[model samples]
Target chain A: MLFALRVAFRYLTANRVQSGLLIGGVALSVIVFVFMTALIRGLALFLTVQTTGQIAHVEMEPPRRIAEVMGPDARFAAQPISTFQRQQIRNWQLMVDQAEQLDHVVAVVPEVNGNGFLVRGTAVAPIALQGIDPSQIDAIIPLSKSIIDGSADLSTGGLLIGAELAEDLGLRAGVPVILRSDRGIERLIPVTGIFRIGLSNVDRRVAYLSIAVARPLLALPNGVTSVSIKLDDPALAPLIAEQLKRQLPLKVTAWQEKNRNLETALESQGRTGNFIQAFALIAIMISIASALLLTSVRRRGEIGIMRSFGISRGFVASVFVFQGVIIGLAGSLIGSALGYRLCLFLSEGITGPDGGPLLPIAPAEGGYVLVIVLTVVGSAISAILPAQAAARLDPVEAIQQ
Target chain B: MTLLKAEGITKSFRTGDIDTLVLKGVNLVLEPGEMVALSGPSGSGKSTLLNILGLLMQPSDGALSFMDKPMSGLTDKQLSAIRNTHYGFVFQFHHLLPDFTAMENVAFPAAAPAGGISAEIRDRAKMLLGRVDLTDRIDFAAMRLSGGQKQRVAIARALMNKPELVLADEPTGSLDRENSARVMALLREINHEDRTSFLISTHDPEIAKCCDRQINVVDGRIA
Candidate 1:
């Protein structure tokens, strides 16, 4: 094998320019593949954020029950958990504290959600009210960054209504509005700010206030409805949710479970990515094979003499095989390094002012390793046909040629 | 003892519907130590007989044996093994690999069978280079050597494995008079010193004059 390798190395280096070109070609193909995957994954991740961004990645709510408690018989209760009514989770602050302690869970905030109506003058419409602590909400959502009108000023006292909801009621910052609950209880509060999250449902019917103000108004003695969670890695939401489900007496839902459209879109995009990668590998294989086939033909006379000198057909074939391996190994390694740097350079150029990458291009270590392995294997596979042709050459005919 | 033998050997090449016979009912034999020359006109099948005898081409009819082992019963691996271990070949073109140094080319036959270049094999290659009077050019790439120097390296390569009989097909055909005489003399000295038999095919009368016996090929049959 070493003898063959030595011969192969000399043959390759003798051509110097072609050998360099082959290595460069393989590297370019690998770069295209690796960079493509990074950009696609990053885009998928960004879309995940857009879909699950305004809402929580995982939401923990009290289990649905017909009755708040079991009868004297103490059988388990089954009931639809309404968004309204006495559905608050008991001891939710403790649950939030514990859930935030879970692996990969970045933030957890107790939330109060209820169905109500907003009324101003002759205009009245239904609304979903959200009550949350300002300090905790900041970690769970980019509330301050999302505000477009007025200030994220639930700090003092007042409400933050959605842009469309405020517009529908002829409301603006500092305007007093009447709020009516599902139970016919009414109260008046002034709007302190407005936010637009690019979603019509949230913009039209949602209103936000500090939990300190809305908790008592909802007639809750203690506890909040559910805990909203944000994870350091949104992809880990499902894993953390599974653990939280086992640890807590509540229903835990990951953003992936709540947003099936995004998951399906990413899945289809992933298939498309795999198709492109397969094509890239095939292209690399064909390029290497085509190049080495010419080399084999040019060396036909040399091969004949070697065979006549008593070198086996196996040895003849392995000479070319060894060439393929060298090309594959050298090309993939150089390409991986080049691709990693290219990804980093490209990601920086295509981002928004918010400092987060606009495309969400992730070039993970596992992804790089997979591409390198495939490139090496694919290159070696490309050598088989040419090597076999060289092996089957008749010594007499080849010498004559 | 007969080191190599052939009986009623025939070879024909076909293209489309026509079959052109290159050799017909040819017989050849090589003893333990002898210098023999095959002389013939162009297309008289002198090179064809050499190729058949050298195991590079299989004869169309009749059997060939090396060290008394018939070729018809041997597998491809066995044939390759016999070719590698017992037969050495020198070609009209020298056929030294252009990318390899003279020393590397000398060690090729021995290095080729085994994967590595062993110390003994390298030393033997150096000794062979010394025998060809190409010791000074041993480290030069075959492409960088003069025509005569390259042929000397080729001669060294053919003797690398110390085969019992060496087949030379017009080994001096491409060289000038001076270089041709030098190459022929080297072959003769090696044959006499190592007791290695030689079956050389050539058109030069001067080359045939130095051989122990001269065999003539007339129209594909020895005359």
Candidate 2:
């Protein structure tokens, strides 16, 4: 086996142009695969960071219902939490408190969420209004750092508005703004701050108010739609979720499950990445196949001589396969290095619409290494057909040439 | 006892709609250490007969025995094993592996075993290269050698397995007159010194004249 490998090594080295072309082709494929996967993963990470930075590690809401209540002209009826529903909501909060007592949990906060319209001197836009505790908001969301214009104080009926939302409303810091809930409940509150997070969903359509003011505006007392929790370590989130499920009185969900749309989008991105990787692998395989076929044809006379001297067909096949594996490994190493550098360049240059860094790309991760290795192995396997054909050649016919 | 025997050997090939008979009812015997020459014009099936005798091809109908063992019903793998252990072949083109050195090419057959090239095999290869008067050129690549030296390396490779039978198919056909004479003389010398039997196919009458026995093949029949 060692002798066969030696001969194969010499054979490939002697054909410098052919070997170089094959290696280059394989390396190009591997680099493309690694780069595309990294891009998709980076996009997913960007979105996750944006969403998680606003909300806590987990959020709970009422289960979805598929019903439309038509009024005078097909207007949907409002689905408000009842007195009994408020008790159920309190029970859920009790569960969140229990979860905070777990070993990994750091804190938990409850918030009421509802859709409302904000108006500043006749300029009006819809917004997702979240009612949070002034003292506990920092523990759960760390929103104080994101404040741009003013503080995140929720006292004395003061509200926080996104930068874009504030601009659209024509409201300055400490200016009074009127907000109306869907149930026609109206309140006049002063804008405490204007903040920008560079996310369209957050900056354009979000407003923050105190939980005490939101309770009467949404026509619910001591009621909240969800309880969000913060963990001491992000990696222990799944374990904490399981512990909460066992301890909490009401149903509990992890952030990944509560936001199924984001999770599904991330999963689809991964699947698309896998498809791109497969395509790159196929390209490498085709290159290896063509290279091995040409090598086998060129070495026909040598193969015949070996056969006549008692070398088995299997041994002959292994020599070409070994050559392919060596080429693939070398190409993958080169491609991975190139891909990592390309990722760094892209991350540094590409920017978000707000002129912030677009994708947060780290160095080559374990996942990138795994993808390159798989591509090399796949290319080696694809060379088998050509090797078998070379091995099965007739010695007499081969030598006749 | 005769070292090799063939009775009623027949072979055919099919190309498209035509079946071509290359050998028919050929009977021959080779005693141990005997040197025989097969001579014929082109299209006379001398090469086909040599191929069948060398176990590189199978006769459509024949009864063959080597060292008292029947060869008629052997599988390809079994036949290959027997050929590797007991026979060596030399082709007209030399067919040396271009990537290998003369010494490495000569030791190729012995390197086929699972444990890889042993010290004894390397020593034997060096000794064979020395016998062919190519000790100095043993480290040279096969492509770098002269035509005569390349053929001599081919001869050394054939003797690597220490086979009982050495089959040559127009071994000197591609060489100049000087190299052709040298290769033929070397084959004759090896036969005389090692007592190894030889069956060679050649179109050159001069080469046939040097063999101990000559068999003429005409139109797929031994005449």
Candidate 3:
């Protein structure tokens, strides 16, 4: 094995110009591979975590009535429930306890959520008025950390308003606001904090108050409108939700199920990334394979002499196989390092309006390992034919040539 | 003791339906430590016979043996073992791997069997290079050496494993007069000092005259 490796190294070094070119090609391809994997996966994770970070991984709630089915025979349709039916969970505390017992369940928080109009001097903008125990909300959404102004406290019958909503109403901390529910009830609530979650749609239309303060205004006494759950692994939300459906009477919804368009968009772009990576791999393979083929042809005499001196076919083939491995490992190392720098450069150079990075690249270590493993495997595979060709040379003919 | 013996050896090649016989019923023997020459004109199968003698080719009809072991019944691996441990070859072209140094080329045959170059092998190779007067250029790559120096390194390589018999097909065929004599002298010195037998094929009578015994082959028969 040492003999073969020495010979292989000598052959590669002897043709520095050619070997350098081949190695460069492989390195470039690997760079593209690692970069794309980091970008696509990083972007996907950023979007999902950013979106799901604000929402619950799984939500358990009373099922909303399905739209009334119109019968083919108009006379046979049953009377449907009115659009104004009350929405509330039946037995929330038992279900929340049971959910906390399920595997991987991190935290469970019950909340009352409904649309309300905030009236402040003729500006009546509609906002989602959500209720939660501020301390418990930390386990689900980290709403406490998300508070950019004043405090996360809602204990004094004060509310947390969105940055955009606050700007719209000319409201701030320590200011009083009138919240009018759709049920014709009104209450004046103090603004305790302002939160900027970085999502414009949510920032423009969401407000938060304590459950004690919100439940009575919304006409719900003890039951919550829904229970939101945080899980150890958000990706496992769907499977857990599926399992929850069988055990609980309420509707169990996964984050992915609620965001189907985001899921499809994420998957389609991931496929595109994979497609690009595959072609880059093929290009790398072609470059290495052709370079080796030329090397085999040029080294025919050396192979013949080695064979005539009793070198086994397998040993000769192994020389080229070793070449593939060295090239793969070297290229992947260089490429991965460069890819990391590229992502870092892009992240720092690009910024959002609010001074945060436009593209926050969270590179997964596993992705880099995958690139190295796959590139090496692909490189070795590409060397097979050339290795075989080198091994199977006719000693007589080769020496003559 | 007879180091090698062949009886009624014949070789042929087919061109379409026409069978052209190169060697027909050729007989040969090499005694231990004796240098013998196979002389023939062009197209008279001298190199072909040399190839068969080196076990690089199979005779169409012949029984050949080295040290009383039948060569016909051995596996490819066994044949390779016989080639590496018992027989050595010096081609007309030298055929040194251009990528390696003279020392590396000399260490090749020993390295081939062991799959690595041992310290002892390197020492022996350096010693052989010294014997060939190539000590000064031992670390030079094969392509950097002159034609005769390359051939001398090839000779050192053939003897790396201390084989009993060395086969040379015009070892100096590509050299000038001075370098050719140098290469031939190196081969003779190794043959005399180590008692290694040699069977060389060439068209040069001057080279054949240096051999202890000469067999003249004409039309694939001993003349």
Candidate 4:
């Protein structure tokens, strides 16, 4: 095997131009595969991280279709959780206490969600209202840094509106606004804070209020719609959810499962990665096949002589296979390194259609290396036909010409 | 005792509707340390007979034995092993790999069984090249050598494994008289020194006269 490798190396070195071209072909394919896969994955990752960072990990609500919650025009719905169902569901305090006892649970917050018409002296506009605990809101959702104006504090009978919503309403800090719930009852609240998340859906029509004020305005008797929990490690949420299901009577879901659409998008990105990688491998195989075929034809007489020297057909075949593997590996390594750098350069420049910067694309380095190794092996296997052809040549006929 | 023997050997090739018989009812035996020359006209099956005896081709209807072992129904791999270990061949053309140096070309057969060329095999190839008086040209590419020098390298390659039987098919056919004589002298010296048996096929009577024994082939049959 060592002797065969030496010969193969010498052959390749002697034909540097051919070897370079073959390796370059393999490298180009690898680069294309890695770059395409990383781009799609990076986009998905950015969107997911933005969405999850803003929303609570787990959202508990009455079993309602997404269409209903999002409203007829796919806008925020005006209705709050019914008073009776809210009473029957476990209280925010009780659920929090129960969740804290679980191994990985860190914190929990109960929230009430509804839509209200904000009127500042005949300047009326609808806004999606979230009622949250002043102390626990930050734990469930990262709201402090998300504040566009005023504060995220819910104790001051104040309200926080999205930046766009606030702009449209012509309201600012220390301004009083009348909020009329779906029941037509109204209460005067001060605009203490505002936020702009740069997402059209959130910034155009969203507001936040304290649970104390929102409960009375929505005609609910100290009732909250959902209990959201935070965990020490988000990945362990599924196991914690199973435990929660066993302990709590209500339905439980992990954050990952709750956002099934995003998860599906992530999974599709993974499939795209696999497909691109397979395409690259196929390209490498083609190059290997061509290289081996050419090598075999050029070395026909040598192959005949080797066979005449008692070298088995299998050994002769192995020599070519080894050559293929060496070429594939060399190409893949160089290509992958080039691809990684290319991905890094592309990540900085890529942006969403909405003008948001795309996330930096960085896949596990070890995983990339594994993929290239597999490609080299696959290429060697693909060279089998050519190798066998070279090996089975008749010594007399081969040397005749 | 016969070192190599073939009995009732027959070989045929089919081209379109015609089947041409290249060898018919040919019987021959080669003793250890003997040098036999086969002289024949073109298409007389001298090379075909050499190929069969060298184990590069199988006789259509015959039995062959090497070192008293029968050679019927043997696998291609088995034939190749016997060829590698027991027989060496020098063709009419040098057939040295162009990419390899003369020494490397000579080392090829010895390198084959080992699956690669080692430093020791390289040294042996160099030594063999030196024996053929090509020490200065050993490092030169086979393609760069003169026709006679290339043939001498081919002869050295043929003797790399110290095989008992060496088949030479018009080994000097491509050379000028001076180079041809030089190549023939090298083959003679190797044959005499190593006691290696040789069966040479050639059209040149001058080359044939140099061998210890001579056989004439006419129309694929010993005449």
**Interface Cα root-mean-square deviation for all models:** 0.9, 1.4, 1.3, 1.9
lDDT of 1 by residue, A309-340 (tens): 88988888888988888888888888888888
Quality of candidate 1's docking, in CAPRI categories?
medium
Docking class of 4: medium
The DockQ assigned to candidate 4 is 0.63
Expressed as tens digits, the lDDT of each residue in A1-401 for candidate 3 is 88777877777788888878888888888888877887788888888888778789999999876543554565665663335357788689999988988998988999998888999999998988889986785766667787888898888789888899999999988899999987778998888999887778778888888999888888888899999998888999999999899999988999999999999999998899899899988988888888898888988988888888777788889999878877777777887887777777767777789787676565453267877888889889998889999988977778889
Per-model TM values vs. the true structure: 0.92, 0.88, 0.85, 0.89
Worst 10 residues of 3 chain A by lDDT: A76-85
Give lDDT tens digits, candidate 3, residues B61-141.
Answer: 988988977789777677777888888889889899887899989998888668787889889999999998899998898
DockQ of each: 0.79, 0.67, 0.60, 0.63
Off by over 4 Å in 4: A60-84, A88-91, A97-107, A114-116, A120-128, A182-185, A218-223, A231-236, A348-360, A363-367, B118-123, B137-141
TM-score (0 to 1) of chain B for each candidate? 0.97, 0.97, 0.98, 0.96
lDDT of 2 by residue, A93-200 (tens): 666666667786777778877889998776889999888787885776666887889888888678888888888878777998889996689988899988776777
RMSD of every candidate to native, in Å, equals: 4.0, 4.5, 4.3, 5.5
- Looking at candidate 4, what is the lDDT of residue A244? 75
- Residue B125, model 1: lDDT of 92
lDDT of 4 by residue, A1-401 (tens): 77677777777787899999988988888787777666666666666666666665654544433332332453454553333332324365777688778786777777777777998876898878778778775786676787867887878889878788788888887888899987578988899888776777777777778888888877766667777777766767788878877777666778898778988888887787778778878878987898889889988887776776567787788778888888888888888888888877655567767565455465433246665878688878977988889888887777764
Top candidate on TM-score is 1
Per-prediction tally of clashes = 2, 0, 0, 1
In model 2, the Cα lDDT at residue A375 comes to: 65
Instruction: Tell me the tens digit of each residue's lDDT in model 4 across B1-223.
Output: 6798889899999899999999998988889999999999999999898888888888989899999889988998788788877888888888777878898889878886776778999989989999988999988988899888888888999888889999999888888989998888888898899999989999899999999999898888888
Between candidates 3 and 4, the DockQ winner: 4
Output the number of the DockQ-best candidate: 1
Clash pairs for candidate 4: A3-B116
